[model samples]
Target: MSMQQFAGGNERFIRRYEYDDSWVIAADVGLDEDDIDVDIVGSTAIIVADTGERVTETEFELPSAGDASIDIHNGVLTITIQK
Candidate 1:
């Protein structure tokens, strides 16, 4: 597992996981907003405000290939396996 802290008051956590193939899971996002948005670009993903106020991008290295889901709480974001 790896972690990175943003200068703009946001943090990210990533873990190497393999389900069907191989996947990288990214989570632990701290956003000061009501809603959150996500953008997936290959192995990289971006998180931002739904109102286009601010944006934070995080990169994850996948193990093989898998899917993920973003969990939200009090403007905090956490990524988990998509079921």
Candidate 2:
């Protein structure tokens, strides 16, 4: 992982966890479920969130390419990447 505090021009807090088969990321961006987008390209995970007040784009390197599952709860964004 790049260990970036935040993605370019992003205004939020992010945390990352590693597992045997995947990486999980959690972001506190205060966004709704319908206002976020996630993708995995090669070894990178990209997250984009757009709300009326703020728009955020974040990315981090993963161990490898994997599938992603995303959900938002109480304004926290959680993403799990399965290798």
Candidate 3:
């Protein structure tokens, strides 16, 4: 697992973990589920969060197959891709 922060002071953190047949991504940002949007196409995943005057975006690569599920709980956005 690895965690990285983008080049901004938006407090956006992205963590990625890889399993045998799946990939998991956890984002730590101070936003609710209703303020976030997720889009996955091909092997790329895009996440966007709108919080007041701050709008943050993150893009990363995922596995080629399967579907992705996203949920936000306690300010943590969890994305899971299953194959």
Candidate 4:
């Protein structure tokens, strides 16, 4: 699961995209206050702090074939999937 926060028009839930080198998961994610961002880039997930920058991005790993799920709670974000 990955969490991100941006100072915008009263919008707490952030957006996340699961992608690979050649395809995108075509999904939007909502973030909460206690969510963590995981860098699942090619099978690597980590927790990162909220860097109040213009744009924040990381890579995501994809399974052989499955669906991706994004969870939104209290302005935090969490992503999960199975291989």
TM-score, cand. 3 vs. native: 0.70
Greater-TM-score candidate between 1 and 4: 1
The C-alpha local distance difference test score for the whole of candidate 1 amounts to: 0.49
Clashes of each: 4, 0, 0, 10
Question: What lDDT, from 0 to 1, does candidate 4 have?
Answer: 0.43
lDDT of 4 at 78: 56
For lDDT, the strongest prediction is: 3
Residue ranges of candidate 1 with Cα displaced over 4 Å? 1-34, 50-64, 81-83
lDDT (tens digit, per residue) of candidate 4 on 1-83: 43333444444333433444222222233434444465454444343535454335544444433443545465455555553
**TM-scores for every candidate against the unseen true structure:** 0.42, 0.64, 0.70, 0.29
lDDT of each: 0.49, 0.73, 0.75, 0.43
- C-alpha positional error of residue 33 in candidate 2 after TM-score superposition, expressed in Å: 1.1
Q: Which stretches of candidate 4 lie above 4 Å from their native place?
A: 1-53, 62-65
Shift in Å, residue 21, candidate 2: 3.4
lDDT of 1 by residue, 1-83 (tens): 34444333333443444345323353445454466676555545566554466554445443322376556766455555432
On residues 52-77, what C-alpha lDDT tens digit does candidate 3 reach at each position? Answer: 78887877776564688888898887
| Better by TM-score, candidate 3 or 1 | 3
